[model samples]
Target chain A: MSTTVEMVRRPSSGAEQAPPSGALGRLRWAVVDGWVMTGRNMRHVIRSPEEIVLYFSLPIMFVLVFGYVFGSGMAVPGDGSYREFLLPGVFVMTMLYGLGATASQIAVDTGRGVVDRFRSLPMARSALLTGRAGADLLRALLELTVLVVCGLLVGWRWRNGVGDALAAVGLILLLRLAFTWLGILLGLLVPNPDTVSVIVFPFAFPLTALSNVFVAPELLPDWLGAIAAWNPLSATVAAARELFGNPGTGGESWAAQHALLLAVGWPVLLIAVLAPLAVRRYQRLSR
Target chain B: MTDETSAVVARGLRKTYGRTTALDGFDLTVPRGTVCGLLGPNGAGKTTALRVLTTLLRFDAGHARVAGHDVTRRPERVRAAIGLTGQYAAVDETLSGRQNLVLFGRLRHLPARMVRQRSDELLDQFGLTDVAGRSAATYSGGMRRRLDLAASLITTPEVLFLDEPTTGLDPRSRNGLWDAIRTLVTGGTTVLLTTQYLEEADQLADRISVVDAGRVVAEGTPAELKTRFGADRIELVVRHAGQLPAAAGLVERVTGGQVHVDRETRRLSAPVADRITALADLLRALQDASIAVEDVVLRRPTLDEAFLNITGHGASERTEVAA
Candidate 1:
């Protein structure tokens, strides 16, 4: 066994210096470390093309199956294609589904002792959580890009032009960011990746099903429609549909009328409520 | 009690998980440039103490200073000075060996150029140069552990903690890790290792702290602990089975100790305080009686025996009261 005598004998120079102190220095290091961690996660996605394919297939399958198999039977509340009405919901649903990946990845890291190793290092405390959020957002961007092309191929054009369309994409990402924080929290709370996988579906299915992701909220019974319209996932889906100039934007409920406000408000609120709790849980992981 | 001479020091450290106490008044002191093994059974608080000292876990009360910085108040400083290889191989399995080292070096704030250079050097040193590009998931158990250790040494920390570093490894891999640890200590890095294997403690540690029920039950050098627990024993096998009784009587008369005679094996055994003199007299007495001896040996108590004597239980037995 060759010893690490060379490592000890060499002059460490700047490498041995203490991490910079103070708020600004800390924030700067946090960004640097978080980026490094993000790069690691991105590499995982790149190396495992099958994982990317698996995630992308879900959204693409929804687009094809809903657009072709069920298009003739389904009805839109407004004068637009059923494919158009369904595409926005599918985009938002894909983002919601991403919650499982984020949660399971974090849970795997924690269960496998990777997070403990990070915690023992001198890097910024928030780097792991922030890195997860950043990587998931980037991944959500890729998924959206692919889904957008798929939607365009299926005759689901955004009639609201470029600016409103960009806003719609932004709302979908915002919802993804909020769900990212929720995923981080759940990942930290859950014991392992298998448990996260088991629980995320039961939690996410009801969320997407009860929302306006599929049927227009107005089509459901009065009591059920109220719950579906107010669902957080519904807000983003409705907002995205309105922004894209797609059909199924009609509803008398305050939530549907204020979809744009709720789209932004719900995400911001979820982030505000979940981010700090996740951070606190990470800091108190040993307890 | 932070001091330059002590790499790790703990005084009355206490931690509880609701109703269960994980660390109750745990105390230790590891001098710089030496290996201190925290030897214990399962659920014996060894890992908890290691976590607390490494700044991965917070203790409820008392104090700890690691690498001359207060553990609770100056955890970042402690973290900066220390490297910890947890019981599990914590290397990123998705990453190649070189990438794992580079990532850790970058996290430690090394310059990009330095990170690359250091990672290459580590890969070469650990004999992973051939497989440096392969993902750690494809590496064997020993290779992954070597990568884990290499990752921890990215910054050549002043203090390193290994929590059962060879827990699940085969003997060959375990020996390889032991040799690596020996080389590291020779390079002057202070190491505090926790292990349930008494042989591991004896092989690696300069000082061993026997832990039981969340506290240090005994602390000493391996030899010192062995001698403290029991005396050396002299055993001889008689060539003639009929001479076993004669040898036993002569052994007791010469050594002034009770002799255990095994007629089937024609063996006589007795514990001796003055090992050398007792052995010499026993051999002379047996020769005088014309009782030929086939084999003779002196055996000191093993660390396993010392641990059992100190903890009042075998090292592998889990104590119910320990949380």
Candidate 2:
């Protein structure tokens, strides 16, 4: 069992006082340290494919139910396919659900005291958030792939060329990245998984319901439609639809006309606002 | 090892959570390569002192240093030198035991090859080689605590902070952990362990600090603390249950101390000032009184009674309730 060898070769490396280096060195260390943690998180995802499948199934269910069951009643801009119109909306919904993925994982880690262990180490303080963001991005990409395949199987195709299709995919990923920060903020604020799940739904429901995710904003009352047009989720969905060359096209609203710019701007703003908020919450955890 | 050098030093540490104080003027000093047990009840601030020294929590007013690094001014240096195995086993349940160790090694900035080698050695040292590939969730309570301790030792930290590390382990596991800890201390690792278990402190600490109400009530070697509290006791169980009252009266008359008797067990026990004279007099008295004694013994004061005497309260009753 090599137990004797283990006893014989005990670590002789006494605490070699590592001097606090300059800011640049610390920043460099944070990147490498974060990448190492990202590898650990990826290993978890690979070992548990069932969890990944579960995450994918929920979004696929929404696509099937909304595209087939609710398709007949929903109005489209023209004779363009309703399945295609629902594709972008379903993808945005999937990202919204992905928000819970981060919250639940962080809550579990906090409850399990893994965060305390991480805090004790000499590694970068920001590595925890960076690692979580990296893994969540990977998960978001996987969810995007599965949803795209489901869309194709249901007769929803990206009519645009490969370049535009990639752009739309990028837009969806960007929105997911933005929500990841929100997930982190919520996770740090609420340490219970059940409470995080409960809180996420209320925010997610209103954000998705009030936007152009499931249906055209024109179908709502004028005031509600105006509000929906400016909702960040609406920008991403509209931009993705336009890029994918789907049924829905640009609308008269300024946000809808410049959907691509708004799509990029919204996530950037969300990241700017929530990233620091999450980091501050994390720093205050031990205090 | 110099007289002037202490692995961990804290003075006048103060901390509060809103209105309630977690630490108040708590002072401690542990010489290098020694195990200083912070013995206290549930809310007596043992954990708080450990947290402050480990750089996990900030103190409101105090000067604390870990491995010669001021915790508040040079926290990174303190963090680099210390290791902490908290009350709860801090490990990922989904990850395999070996994976958890490797991840921590990598985070400590160990070289890639060294990370793998050290992880293997730790797994083996903790007697987890066979189950290294298994998820930590599948491990027994003892195995999990060992893994947690192993993770903290990835870099051979100078000052290891153990905050109730054996709180929930079975007897066998607790002993195994204690052995592992002893080996580390022998290898020159300074340790600060906090525990509510008097037996744990008595068995492991070179010096024990009895903490109460966020401060140190008493500090001394285990033997010294026991001696300072009170003298040893003489206990006797009569051969016949009916002779209990007679034995109790005889013991009180001989020792001139309060005798406590259990009527059901026919057992009587009382404190004795001088061990040899008291034992001799008690035995001669029992014989003169024609009392048939089943058993007689003399024992020193336990850390439990000493702790109760010092703090005026028993240690946390959580473990007792669990038992």
Candidate 3:
């Protein structure tokens, strides 16, 4: 206890300087704060559970609308159950919708000056960003779990084994991690609360609905289908369809093989591209 | 700058947004352990300068050093040694008062145990122990300000920056904050405060620097600044508008300074020395002149007068300060 008191009397032992460059050091910090603040974020949700009820129900309503009302007309490229094929689309769709709420929370923080307070404090520079990303990833996981539970209630099932199902979950989370940075980037870009929905809604639909989340890309118009086929979300849904027992058949598209790679690649690439710029921008807000 | 103790030094800080310049070659020097007031009318670049010194905003040109460390080059070390409370109380509405302090303590890298102890100590010291467990959203404005100040002290920073810390506060709350600031200064913290209220600077600032349009218009102790631009003012209210002429002549004869007569109010005003004796003589002279006087008042120089003199009708205030 004396040692602890003595330690506080001296300078902070945290990253006063920049962190040492290595995978181990970076990942160590990423995981340490990743877990602590993730718990804290979850506790905030627990206390204000009503705040998320709207987010939880909205997408489930959309999935039901698409499955029962729109599924008969919509064509899938492969044969077999539409529920199996549609489930991956719904999973990917739910992940994309998570960005809207998360991004707006950041805008609220920005407006309330909480983001500025975080910047002024002498913490791990990356801790705030990493904690946010970690919590959003957790939110994505929870959202995925709920959508799956709802799917089960709706008589939806994946024919894959335990490992394959788990692999599909990993792939969906990987997709979420990539998109979370994109959400943070939007949050950083749009600093005002009133304009957040204006920014997130258009991007959410174009990125999610225009892709294979509900229908096969070939079913889209010639021009629209071309764009949808290359969207990274389309790749994720296609890859999930294959990994979760090929709800259609063991088919492959150019987007399927590379989309997951891009899904994994995008988050790292985004953190590389957007995180520093956003941190720098966040630092100089009133400047 | 003038052999001041120099706790903080800033030179040529500049920032521009589009076509307008917010700060232009601004320079400042603050002595250690003194409460320095950055007194300015609106749009005077006072907030810009404070933001740069606190390591929250970067300047396009020039430099600032806080507690002997360059803010630009060593922002982490600078941030470690400094605390800032903005004009608005930026308290998290979600957290309780104690939780707010503990959150800042943890962000400042205090251990869990120390965060707890220091948070309690601050709550007690700030007269907030009873309400510490309550959510800040439920707090009064004064309580939120106190908690915001408490959060800044979690690390016991050496240099504290307050930007209009008492704006919108009632008289009682303002004095309470003044007392807290004095206590901190006595404990060896250097404070740079910007305020629009002249009385606040008069009561609290060891020295006041009046900024106008991105420049320091005047910098000196309250006495020195007042003496440079002020004199003893004597006002006499005559019985009628016709008597203003008699009052003006009698005042001018004694003081030999210009007498300004308001015909509507039947009052005569002039600058002089030994204003009380002057008032006594003027009263006697008024009797001889048969000018029936109603009342008399001596107006001494206030920081308000000094502020008006230094920043007379500055248009930049439109952008710098808000009601």
Candidate 4:
């Protein structure tokens, strides 16, 4: 400690100076800085693979229990089997639950004072949020892969060709992206990770369970069915079913008929609303 | 680059959270390359003042400058020149010590090679080289704090803000931290420290500012503040327990200060002035009376007494402090 103090007291070389000068140069560094932050967050996930496994476990459990236990007497009123019909809903449910991960991560970061540390640096304002979003998107892709494999193991096959199947996976990820912004918004708004889980539970449980993911909205009471049909989760699930060429293809509702468009529209709309809200929440944090 | 010679300056900083006022018209100025101790109780606006200056928070009304840059208008410039180590460790627990340093170095835009070298240098300097590969979560409290301090120093910031940096450390760790802080100041890093521990302030600060009710109530050198607000104490421990009363009377007459006698310990204490003459007179009087004395000492008022005198209360007085 004393030697370092002496080293600092004397004039040192300017080796650790700022990277570059000018506005344009800073803008370039900002992009690179964001990538560095992304790598930092990704390293955490790598170090703790068990955490990722635990997060993935929930969706897998839901698939088996719902597929086997409920599949025995279940009917889809279409050519596709109930197991096939349940696959897309389970995927959507996984993505929906992923919103909590984003929220809790942000809450933990904020509570730990890492957010303040980042804010105090000369780095770009968007680096922290963008870095988190990047890691979460990668995580979402991993979960999607696991769920797809599990779906195959449980007799849920995608009859559609490569192009359509890829599109369905893309839609699921797009929904994840939308929910990621919502998570960021909630994370910034809440005080801690525990509170984030508490708040997210009420919304996630009802929204995922009532949507067309688990049961047809048409089977529910009239008002609830209308709500379920219009739910953003329902649109994504219906779209995934259509893309995978699964049976029970959203049965006769106008929402089912236009699944692909609504699936794309819901995420776009959510991003448009939640992304700015998240940014604003971040900016107004200590104000 | 700017005309301001002080490392930090804040004027009329006012911040409120609903009905509670965290900072109310607070003002401070810390000179360049000097340690400024912001001493106050738990609910005092010490942390709030730091947050505003570091650009981590926005005050409702204030004009603050750090490293000659306007904190609100030119925050990036201020941030570039300043580093803040908050009350919490503020480190990524999952990352190794070296990894945390590298992450901060990269964020500060240091060259990749420079970052690696700097991380190694800092880890060695802070005696963290052996554990640099381990996650910070595995570190002892002292080690985590050292790592946190290293993270803030990645770019050799012009001004460092340490808010209660040693709130929970043992005596050994606290001393280690104080040594590190002294080294930083010797190297010409201006520091603004806020701590509830009066000893920490006395050990670290060149100038001490007593903050209470969201503003500075008193500001001066530690010696000056102590002299102004504290009195010298004269203590006499008699060889015979029965001599306690006689010693107390002799000391009271010599010093003319309030005297407190503990008969069980046979100790007599009194606040005194003109320490040299008071001690001389008291000793001579006791000698003439043939009173046996085991110990005689004149002690200056402790920082705790000075703090309580200036703040009008102890640090434990948390009620209505935020208001």
Candidate 5:
């Protein structure tokens, strides 16, 4: 113990000087701190092999269940195969379910006092949240890559040109980015991490069921179809089907006809509204 | 006021949540390079005061300065100068111990080259070098706390805030933490510690501020606090319960203080000013009175008794529910 005390008595040789001043310096530090935090989160994902397996398995199971188990019984609105139509919906659905993961991770960090340490540090106030958004985006991209490969194995392909297919992938990621913000807000708002799944599942299930993920909105009843057509999830799925030239493109409703417009508009609107709310909630935590 | 001689100063800090007040008129001043202990039971606002000073939570009204910067207006400057280890160990459980320190160093704006070097140094100093590559989740409670403390020290802070650093640690680990804290103070770092253990405050703090119901009810050095409440006392147990009254009277006459008698225990006690002489005088008088004394001892008031005298309750009593 005396040796331990003697060791601690050594002077700290790497004491940091005060942070740089001025707006430019502050912005630079924000970016540096944000990147550091992002790396920290990425390490967690890499080290937890079991968590990665669990997260990826859900989307893979969904791909198998919807693509093969129900493909023969399901009907497509147009001439294309049902798996082609189902793949786009599955891609969009995976992004929507990702909201649960984002929320629970944030909640767990908050509960464990990690956020309190970050709040007390000299780092930029926006770094924690922006870092989370960055990490979630990267993880979402990985999920998309695996799902895309699985779709190919199940007889899904893009009839449209490569450029349109790439654009469709862009739209899917944009929706994911928006959902990331929503997850962050929900994570900060939840009282505990255990409750995030409870709230997220109830909310996400109804949303996916009401949208055109499993069936075209045109096949539903008049009122139910109108609600499904306008769902934010429907906008992204409908636009992706159009770009991929898959069957089950939505009917002539304004939301379906202008699928590309709504696809971009909905995510932009969600980011615009939810990002500020999440930031505000983070700033007021434990007040 | 941001004075050069003071590392921390708070005046009338007030914080409330809905109808509950967590801190009310909490005031403190800690001199530079000294340790000040905020001693209190649960729900006494010790953590709340720490949060306000560290700029983690806002107060409804108050003025506080840490390391010469206003806590509310110049929070970033305060944050740059201080480190906080919260009640819970805040290290990333998924990351290895070395990675946690490096992450905090980078976040604190240390040079990339220096970050790894500093982390290795900290891991060695904290006796965690042996397990530096293992994930923090696999570390024991004591190791995790040491890592948490090391993370806060990525750069030597001018002041450090430790909120109950040894709350759940075993006796050996608690002593190790105390020695580590002492080493930090010796190296010229001012520390503000909060704890529910009176002995911890007595052992490590240069001064202690006893808190109750969100305010500092008493403030002094450990010895001064004990003396302020009262001096040493002579307690004796009579051989027979029938002699308790006689023993009580004899103790009063010798000590010149009120004697408290307990018939059930056959014991009598009275405060004494001149401890040795009073003890000798009481013994001689009791012998002359033919009161059979089974046992006698002189004892000074513990901080627990002083706390009870000041707050009108024991130190372990929870006056209000709080986080």
Candidate 6:
């Protein structure tokens, strides 16, 4: 290289002294910055796929644990394939499991200065947050796909046609989106990434275990059953099971139709509760 | 570094975190085609002021215009006008240097072809051509820093904000950075820099502002601030440890100020306005008192001393902020 030009790593090259040139030009610049960060984040996930594998493995592992170990001894209060009854439970639990895992990603971003890097850039305020939500939702959808493939191999089949299968995936994706928002809210509210696991354990245990995903909603205790039926995860699982005839349980009722409404509603409610809070917390982060 | 216009201006800037103010009625003006250094020690609101200017943090009170647009009212426009290398970021460790620069170019909305071209150009310019394809995770601290700066320039911003551009670098890297900055300044780009290193300010800043406790205590050319706030440091290394007393007395007689001695170093030191002339008189008096002198040196007070005098604590010492 010639001697005229030297390498520089200064945070600012010469920005503080130059005059403003154009207005439209700068807005376009920020939009572009968002895409760059999005690509960077997605690439990071590609490099470290351990989280993806673990997330996908969870539902399949839960299915085996319950089907062979608990299925024969357990009854749905009727003669139905216990495998079919348990399948829906595992699927719903898989979707809800995304919440805490999503939080850990946000916490890591906060700790690693990735958030700080974007905060200092010319990118839009919503870009980074929106990008994170987008990435996590996609991750959840991928995890769902893997779990569905495993379910198919394990004698779980959807009776509904191609359209219904797409709709099932869509419903699960939407539910995961809601959970992801909740995860983001928690990540933002918490102080650091290290505390994320501690926070995650509490949310994971009850949200996954007490829902209709593992046992029949009716088998739960009088007080717990009512709460279990209301879990959005329960609604989603019931809807999917209604669409696909689970291994042996063939009870498709109006509850499946209502499950659609609940699946959509849960995310809306989560966004209602968490979106603004997350934005406000993010706004204060750079301070 | 194409010929660019004025990058930033902040007038009547004030910010308070709870009851403790971070920036108290601070004002700054940076003209086009020059490097303006925002020189200050720790906790002096330099970062706060930069944050406000970058549109990262909003001030409770004050009018700030970056790239000729109000920072609060038109943040995106300000962001468009400048590039912030960022105070605490390096490269995206997951990406190669070339990928990082290209990604930033794409984010700035450049055409895909142009992004590739710009990335290549930046890699060549920053001496990162060889490692352009390697992930930044494996790069040294200095290489990562260079890639970070390269990322910042993907848009060819008219203005730049560099906060402590060379704090932890070795001398060679620091000099390389200084040369790079000089080239940028020569080509008429605007720069705002904040640094604790006085020599960096003296070498690069068109003007220096000494900030302490969230206020600019002094602002001028390095020589001018030194003249106004700095006194000559008259130091005496005693011939023998016992001669420290006689040497201290002679210094007191010469300067009419109490001489201070560090018990550990066994040296006599005093402040005097005319360091060069005072040195001659001090040597003569010490000899007359038969006080042997091991060594003597007269110098202007360093910014460290000036910071202690102004802020009442060494800049290096950490003071807990009331959170």
- List, in order, the clash count of every candidate structure: 0, 0, 2, 1, 0, 18
Candidate 1 regions with alpha-carbon error over 4 angstroms: A1-4, A8-17, B1-4, B18-20, B239-243, B280-296, B317-323
TM-score of each: 0.93, 0.90, 0.87, 0.88, 0.92, 0.83
TM-score, cand. 6: 0.83
Query: Which candidate ranks first by TM-score, i.e. highest?
Result: 1
DockQ of 5: 0.50
lDDT of 3 by residue, A1-287 (tens): 00012223423323233433577865664565455555556656665778779768876886688778887786667576676678888888888777776677667767775555666765555666567778888877778888888888776777778787887788788777766776766777887756875778887887776887777777768778777777777777776776677564333455555655755665466557766776666555646
Which tens-of-lDDT digit does each residue in B90-204 have in candidate 6? Answer: 5567778887787666545556876787678778877899998888888876777677766767765667888788878788777877777777777567889888787888899
For residues A1-287, write the lDDT of model 4, one tens digit per residue.
33444373322323345535688877787788779888998999988889978988998999999999987777685556899999999998898899898999888887777778898888888888888888888888889899989999999898889999999999999999999999999998896899898899899998987888777777788888888888999999999988998876755678868989999999999999999999888888668
Off-target runs (Cα >4 Å) in candidate 6 are A1-38, A77-79, A247-257, B1-6, B232-314, B317-323
* Cα misplacement distance, residue A260 of candidate 2 (Å): 2.0
Which digits, one per residue and each the tens of the lDDT, describe model 3 over residues B1-323? 44334778888888777777778888888888899999887778888888788877777898788878788888876777778888888777777788788777766656678788888877887778999888788888888888888777776567888989998888888888888888778777889999888788889999888877776778999988887756778887888777676678789999889998888877789988887788888888988888788888998877666666677753234553411
Worst 10 residues of 4 chain B by lDDT: B314-323
Q: What is the DockQ of candidate 3?
A: 0.29
**Candidate 1 local lDDT, A151-246, one digit each (tens):** 988898888899999999999999999999999999999958888878989989998888888789898899989999999999999999888989
The better-scoring model by DockQ among 2 and 5 is 5
Q: If both were scored by lDDT, which would come out higher, candidate 2 or candidate 6?
A: 2
For each of the candidates, the C-alpha root-mean-square deviation to the true structure, in angstroms, is: 2.6, 3.6, 4.6, 3.6, 2.8, 5.1
Candidate 5 per-residue C-alpha lDDT over B54-144 given as tens digits, one digit per residue, 9 for 90 to 100: 9988999879999988998899899888989978999889899998998888888777888888788788878899999999999999999
Best by DockQ: 1
Candidate 3 regions exceeding 4 Å error are A1-44, A72-79, A218-226, A257-286, B1-5, B127-134, B237-244, B262-266, B273-297, B314-323
Candidate 2 lDDT over A1-287, as tens digits, reads 12223335545444332544998888888898889878888888987989878988898899888998998788887668788899999998899888887998877876677788898888888888889888999988888888889988999888889999999989999999899999988998898988998889988999898998877887788889899999999999999999999977777789889999999999999999999999988888668
The TM-score obtained by model 2 is 0.90
lDDT of 1 by residue, B259-298 (tens): 8888888878888889999888888888889989999999
- CAPRI tier of model 4: acceptable
Candidate 2 error regions (>4 Å): A1-20, B1-4, B234-298, B317-323
> Which digits, one per residue and each the tens of the lDDT, describe model 2 over residues B241-299?
87788888889987889999888778899998888898898899888888899889998
Candidates' DockQ values?
0.57, 0.43, 0.29, 0.48, 0.50, 0.24
**Residue pairs with backbone overlap in model 3:** B42-B317, B43-B320
Q: Is candidate 4 or 5 superior in lDDT?
A: 5
